[model samples]
Target chain A: MPQLERLWNEFKDKGLHIFHVESQGTSEDDLKKFCRAKGMTFPQVMGQGSFSGYEGGSGIPYAFVIGADGKVIWQGREGYHAVITEEMAKVRFPGLGKGSVAKGLEKAAATFAQKNYGKAMADAQKKLEAEKGKSSADAAVVADAEHIIARATAVGERLQKKAENAKAEREYAIAMATYKILEDGFKGQPFGDNAATALDAMKADKEISKEVKALQQLDAMLAQLEKAAADEKKKNLKAFAEKFKGLKAAEKADQMAANL
Target chain B: MRRLGATVLSAAFLFAAPVLMAQADLKGKDAPDFKVGSTINEAQALSLDECRGDVVLIKYWGVN
Candidate 1:
């Protein structure tokens, strides 16, 4: 647990967001106290995690590393210290540690940090090409530029594949969400443009749009239900499941209602 | 009562956490949303949806 805390301290600003979820059915109050006692600063989610999709193995102390592209990249109970660090290193610009990026790549790095992969890559590469043999730090600057482009391209590709896979499986919600990430984060990049086109195409389909709306409705309702009483949640959830019948999110609503 | 009831229901899950964390098998799988009670240590609780373009480490822990 302390190790995870240390990891968070090391990379919190580098696109690493940690959520300390309470799965032992610990009350929110107790969860807060526990976190306080340990001086932990990451966000803590108090709930009985369904542990859905959990194939079951190492119980408790388990983890799931969802990448910047919204795909689960790594998961395990232990021995993942290196994996965690390595995964984080992928997101930090210049494909390096938490150090300040090279001076020549500052503007590009700022763009990348803003989640603009296409522009950042193009900017960095253009700068790299222009710097061919001008500076004494040619080798170092060239390396950073290449790393940024490669890493950005990799993230964009993975998200493209994930969105495609989700759409192919008719998981509209996941597909739409991923496509949005690509559209917003990739900019003029190839995969990012492809995702944007696909997203526009998806919105044009009546059936797909309906499915997406149903998902949005479910998410909005769930957000509302968070503050609601148990009895109220049960009642509302029943109505939602019946109304949004046949949708996965509605099925989830059913499960939540039953558990309530 | 709402909070207490949630605690009780979450406890029932004690006997049923997932098998093991399997990144290899679960890669690209849509992670199911877990029950959320409150935000601790942060101003707002983060849903998986809000984590796009960011790597989120969901550490499921327990304390009696």
Candidate 2:
């Protein structure tokens, strides 16, 4: 392990960027201690959930060898340093090397931060689509990553709206939703001072209550629909009937018939 | 030569595959088996076996 760490430190200066992906359950302190003990100075990452996406899935210390075209050419499980070292040696140096996906992602994140929504969306979509079939051993983690990225993109769309046309109320709502998505969706992300300030501004606004109420209404409606679906599946006519009672008389009749 | 290379590769995987497989299942399932010091100020190794039969709180953070 010391030898591998030394090798990584020696070659990291020459386009060997290491990205550590910590699992949802893993303690960051352990990662920090391990990295510090090994004298590593690489970017450490955390996931939304367990292994959910790539065909094989990914976990801590997994490595990706992305091609010059911003596509992953090689991906390996944890502690497979020699796979990377040997492959990188065989390939040309100072050239278009691996980890284009990470680079592409970093570029997209930068563009998003700069409020370049159009370019950022395009880059994010490309990066996500390109990672379609790759899987690590864990399915849940992969699923969480996919779900988190989707939620992030949706939040980005709302934020993009706020960026383009700054309607006070809409911006406030979008900003609040964005904060929640970032906080809940991607744990341990470096949400800088700007996000903090924007959230504070939104919280102080008077119209926040109205937006909150509206969101509550949406949640209630969704819960109603979910309960209705579940009741119908169980053939619980009384439960289904009770759930549809708040609807208009005609709509109630229609729902009752649908359930029947 | 080719057979020797295959044998070496197979041996390396046999030793490393389970560790890699376990690491890959970090999210969704119960957290991975890890033993870290309980308190930041302390130097005790707390393993999952020690925390068994109890609800354990797991927190992930970046140290500055």
Structural similarity to truth (TM-score) of each candidate: 0.52, 0.26
Model 2 chain A worst lDDT window (10 residues): A92-101
Q: Report each candidate's C-alpha RMSD, comma-separated, in the order given.
A: 14.8, 21.5
Off by over 4 Å in 2: A48-63, A78-83, A86-260, B1-64
- Candidate 2 C-alpha lDDT tens digits along A1-260: 46645755665534344334444455766665656545555445445332233323323334444322233445554434554565454332221121222433656544443434445455666666656655642444333334335434554444434433433444344457666544443334333234455567767866665554544544455455554755453354344435544323223334434533
**Model 2 interface RMSD, one decimal:** 15.9
Tens digits of per-residue lDDT, candidate 1, B1-64, equal: 9999999888766644443223226657755554344467641224554345556677666785
Error of 1 at A226 (Å): 3.9
Q: Which segments of model 1 are wrong by more than 4 Å?
A: A1-14, A17-98, A133-137, A165-171, B1-64
Evaluated on CA atoms against the true complex, candidate 2 attains a DockQ of: 0.03
Candidate 2 per-residue C-alpha lDDT over B1-64 given as tens digits, one digit per residue, 9 for 90 to 100: 9999999999999988876664333332443444442232211113343222222223222233
> Could you tell me the TM-score of chain A in candidate 2?
0.29
